[model samples]
Target chain A: MARVLTIGEPMGLMVATEPKALKDVTTFRRYVCGAEVNFAVGMSRLGHETAYISRVGNDPFGQHILDFLAEQHISTDYVTLDDVNRTGMQLKAKTLEGDPEVVNFRRFTAFSYMEPSVVDTVQWESYDHLHVTGIPPALSETCRETSIAMMKAAKAHGVQVSFDTNLRPALWPSEDVMRKNINYLASLADIVLPGLGEGKILTGFETPEEIADFYLKQGAKAVIVKLGTKGAYVKTTDETFYAPAYIVENVVDTVGAGDGFAVGTISGRLEGLSWSEAVRRGAAIGALQVQVESDNEGLPTLEQLVAYQNSAKLSE
Target chain B: MARVLTIGEPMGLMVATEPKALKDVTTFRRYVCGAEVNFAVGMSRLGHETAYISRVGNDPFGQHILDFLAEQHISTDYVTLDDVNRTGMQLKAKTLEGDPEVVNFRRFTAFSYMEPSVVDTVQWESYDHLHVTGIPPALSETCRETSIAMMKAAKAHGVQVSFDTNLRPALWPSEDVMRKNINYLASLADIVLPGLGEGKILTGFETPEEIADFYLKQGAKAVIVKLGTKGAYVKTTDETFYAPAYIVENVVDTVGAGDGFAVGTISGRLEGLSWSEAVRRGAAIGALQVQVESDNEGLPTLEQLVAYQNSAKLSE
Candidate 1:
């Protein structure tokens, strides 16, 4: 089986314990860091051979993440421990009063201080596929350089690279800086996944087609733009396709849905699924994600995925 | 001054937000609820004549007792929104490993269903102390009867009542039950203040006692239990107090630190040096809150009370 590697900083996540506003609630739940790590855990649960790469603090939270990775069966051979800084964290308020609000407490955190010294020790040649995201580039200069170095090393070792533009405005200095940095990272990937809104911001394109075209021209072999309930748009060298969103009964949270879509598409590619089938899998997984609370907790096992796909077809 | 009134459920508050456990946060903050209607908003800041009394949703959380009234400017105009059902809410998580843990979801949601017929219309003749917690015996047959009857007749007689036990649970069998039962009818209060932690189940409490104990004894006058940086906790009786917690370098959040303790404490009590010299002003304000993330915000505002008492002693 081909081995898949995902790298990024995962910080702690705090979400509202109930539907009440933040000022109203007297409690909250806690979860460990990074968006990409969440997806890695999901893919590993689907029985894929997956490895995660990142740096974490030397504190209990870091140990907790490591223990969590081991429990999820994702490889942590490439993970590093930082002695000085502590882990990062984010708090999501339980408010429907406005746009889903998130308060980040990750400034100057250990994840943002990840250095090239940590990256230099990784064994890049062992993985068949590598997944990267835009967040690392915006964290710190050292992390940005590490992202570029990892991509270059992966290319040299003939590993396919997939990139997700998980834009977080609070982490960056300005929109222009974020766009420039993210676009630069996209140029190093073979596959690019960008959410509809994120794609618009990164490529300055209003429509998915325009966004996909922009990435494809930048050297991505294929580009997929995630459109929440409406599905996704895919573009390749010679053709493009549109996949409709899977209908879900409720959308409890939309936080990790995009990451779920990326997992489906990337894992499908590794398994040699058809382009259409891969995008279909992406939409299917994304649909499941919104119905649950955690970022990757609702990801389906391979058997579950097949059953869901089969049921969808039978219903049609 | 103007007389203010409020009505709603008051829940037991346990906060678990500090780096240490719940016991450690004890030195953190304190305040009470059910009585929170008077102390939290009505009695302290508004300086209006205020009264509060309600049977709490019965459970260990029901220990709210007379604590809500002793600390603020509230009087026991009508107290008793009690129920056999669980008192809603528990400690909110400060870390990211898990979401805020709840003891129960208020299985019967007994507080909101208070009956209007049982409230004695003649009860409003005593004076101008009108306050209420969101939870009342109203959740069940006897409780609801007491709340509706008391509130409607009070309003007709020009008595001002404030309602604030913001939201208990949403899965109360139906939405119509929630909207028609909870907000629309409860909004008749003269002043209303529901906060972040008060609205959802998670992402709220950081400290417990400091957040829940500012309200006073049920039979007494006035209350307020919000614990914002240890500032402010007012109640009627013959004494009032103010004590701020030791300053901290970082404030994770100041969510419910204001509302759960503001109502009656700042608005109701008699104003004089004697009124400001009591430790119950701090003890009632300093109870078991501040350990959680949301419910109770911080310690009682007792420094002013101590300073005033010391000055009175020197004069004597």
Candidate 2:
């Protein structure tokens, strides 16, 4: 039995080799990156037994993703193969200043058309935690049903659930439907992690406290509000805390910082850490993630995490 | 029967949507862009009767490429479908200041594995001009042999040949091998087009005149030296001419500018334009290409070219 299970579509990632604009670039590098896969990789690096369950195309890119997971020592037995469509992908270009430009290439991607019957083979009772995001549902109706089915099965088996509102506006038809469906999913999760901006848009809340409160009122056991570089705010039935951000000298890439934060929080909680301690670990890991490129390449192992924490205290 | 025939691998192109660093990009857009296809598209737009000969994977991308060629009204009857390897692709990143970054995904590509047997199906006697690049030879041994075989067949059938020294450093084992192979290819061409930098490195020549002289001595009837934004210098058996640069207002993308120049020069020659007129058209097209984003999107139509030339003369 794994400590954590994450299910979503993993896409082939294409990036500019240098910090040149898209029009001027003559070369690029390739990798596998997705929000769910990032979390799975991060959790596995942090000494958790993580299982990634999803469908990938039977293409070279799909093989590349499987090979990558094998190298990371993450379990993929639950992943199915799709023959009809090719794996999804994304292209990224970055400049010297400001946020990176992103474009989605997942329309009619293989995973979007994954049959619901494939999820029946997944062992529901073998995981302590189930982590999901809003992307799979918005991909296709079949994927939406699969997501809902997985959530229901996990709940029935008494597994803890974590849902991140990783909303992609381009994937959805309208804001109203997105909010309705995502909010419904939030009610099924034990813990809800949503960025301040995402929560504000989904729930029409202006402040972090209001955003957290909205989710908490929607049957969540706890709500963690991500505030970008300012760290996160946590609100539970009996307690609350504001975890301060760790300052890093340079911010190289910001793609998978949130997933890193999720890994830290999930791993810390599973290890029986205090709520504040878990949030602190999350902040530390998230800060470290921004200094490196790639989604999971910057993830720290459990030993490295402890060393970073100890070194910071010693220097203070 | 077409005036121009181009032989090379046409790869699918995946690009990042916005100006985001590789590590921070979360999405991408997909298109089909390659050196040969770029040249074919440009020439077709310039009113040249062009035929493209190559192999593509029997995949959606291949189908898409066929559809795109039809949309552009370029002939694709000579394109073969491969059952084994998939179509090659390149990932491009959006640029901010200079040239956009490019990453090649062409290993074991279907076009690289093109069998020499496929060339038997191509009608070599019908074409007036055949344009070849160094990339086909660098792909694989099979592709290299096919390139050699095609050149021999074209020459045996009395087809004029134009070769471009589009050097890809990473594709070759060493600089020595690249130079040796490229120079041998130059010997087979009636007219050779080499960038100033490429000519310097390949022939160890300091001046464009020296580089042109070297190729001319190597059996080339003429040589045109590309000087980037400075325009081009042409040396033929009859005369020598230097085309002045056309000043662009703002440079958007520069990926396919060289190919655009090739298209203009080839179309001009086929139309019986004088050496100076051909080089001038090349410079005008190259200048126009840098102001557009996609590699082949900004190629000027025959009407556009005439209007541009007429307007420029009026302004002067």
Candidate 3:
């Protein structure tokens, strides 16, 4: 099995069970959430040897996250327990359709204390792929330096890098700083994933082709532009194509669709599938995520993925 | 020493160390805080046998607060450890003058699950006084019932009751409801402590004597009105007078000054001090609370209080 590695902050998520504004929501159902959390769980479900790295506080939320990761079969050997800082928490308001309203209390959390020392312990040579997002750089100066260090180490060890340009303007000090740092990291990855909106801001481009061309010129092997309901567009030195989006009649929550897409694409490529086939799987998984509620719960196993693909073929 | 009992939700307080708004602040110092927390700690410091009743979660914040209560020598025999619901939390911004900005996340907490059964378990006959606030009734229906039940039990066992109209308008559904419930609770107490603004809204009276007469007619033996810098105005069935405020040159925070005032007044009476002398102690403690950053850190021990009184006498 291909070993995949990803890192980011995992926060305690308090999901409102009832449909109400956050101020009016009295009771909530707690869950574990993060961008990298979804990607790791998705990779694990597809039979990949996925390992996650991060720091958690000596709090109940931290303990709960560790137990959850263990249950999902993701290795937590690299996770460190911090005694001083606290685990981050977020409260989400429930909605019937579209994205839920979320307020994150993640500033100065335990994860923000992550430094370059943790990256020094990682066995980069043993991993086939490394997954990362723009979030770590936005956390703290140390986290930014460490994220860049990890990516550089991956390249030196012949490990394939996949970077997701997940823009969080609120977490960044300024737009100029966020764009500069995010683009630099994306240029270091073999495959870069950016939503249409993120692409426009990061590259100052009007179209998906222009956005893809901007990253491809920076030495990226391939750049994928997510086009919402229109699916995704990809551009490489050799070829370019579009992966049509699957029709999801009822879109429940669209929070983790990007991470799911990353999971399907990365897992498909690791299975020795063609680039077009990998992009198709990414589209299928993105469709699956919007139909369910929680972040990684909708991720399909290898058997389930094959079943879903076969059924889609029959319908077509 | 007199046995003093009090009940309410104790929360994990994260106080911003820097003079920035909560959104701009990164690091915060954690502390155990609540209305009753301050009162209990104050009473314990004065060598009173103080006991606190409430429910806390199985989370880290809950455990931390329990440890803190134990450190202050407040009896936790009646505090229940809830496994399901979580302990509430609040984040306060640092300010140089007046009250600090506070954001509370206390809805549907572990303490909200408190029922009348908890009141039934209390050894009412052994306690000399029961302290309560308007906050408990605003928590939930079960908590309101429990609070009312505790007060009824205190009266039946000849235990004196002191009600603090610490108005929390945001926690209530409406102002009318708050007035109705708080006034009902105040009428049942031997002494009622209401801030000037609270007295205005609750009784629609412009003068302290008029507000005092309102509660006095409703069966309250004494009514104490907190008049901010003007100190306090007290009207018992027998006497009426004003306790002038102490000169506090530098005011840091005024969040828990009322609780400190309540602690001084209650503890003084338990020591068999005259009403005027007790109110003077209340004014002194309130002055001290404004000089410190944390809620209960400024609350003086018996020794410190005596020393402060002696020093103030020398200065005067």
State the lDDT of candidate 1 residue by residue for A1-316, as single tens digits.
Answer: 5688888887655566767544344455656547788789768967888998888876545666787788899988988787766565555655443235564445455677766665567676677988999888887898898888888888988999999998988678899999998999999999999999999899888999999999998999999988877888899887699887787766777777888888888888788988888888888888777776666777888888888777753111
Ten residues in a row with the worst lDDT in model 3 chain B? B307-316
Q: How well does each candidate superpose onto the true structure, as a TM-score?
A: 0.54, 0.57, 0.57
Q: Report the C-alpha lDDT of model 3 over B1-316, residue by residue, as the tens digit.
A: 8999999999977677689765455445667789999999999999999999999986656877888899999999999998767788877778979899887767567898999899888988779999999998998999889889999989999999999999899778899999999999887899999999999999999999999999999999989999988889999999999888777888999988999999999999999999988988888888888888889999999899887776653112
Residues A1-316, candidate 2, lDDT per residue (tens digit)? 2488989999887666678644344455677889999999888888788889888876656777887888888899987777656677666675453356665556667788766676578777678999999989999999988888888888988999999989887788899999999999888899999999899999898998999899899889889999887888999887887878777667778888888888888778888988789888988788777776676678898888888776642111
Residue A257 lDDT (model 1): 81
In order, what lDDT does every prediction score? 0.60, 0.81, 0.86
Fnat, model 3, is 0.00
Expressed as tens digits, the lDDT of each residue in A1-316 for candidate 3 is 7999999999877676678765445345567889999999999999999999999876656777888899999999999998767777876668899999886767677899899888789988779999999998999999998899889999999999999999999888789999999999998999999999999999999999999999999989988899877889989788898878777888888988999999988888899988889888987888788877677778888888878776653112
Model 1 root mean square deviation, Cα atoms: 17.6
Candidate 1 total steric clashes: 204
lDDT of 1 at B158: 71
Clashing pairs in model 3? none
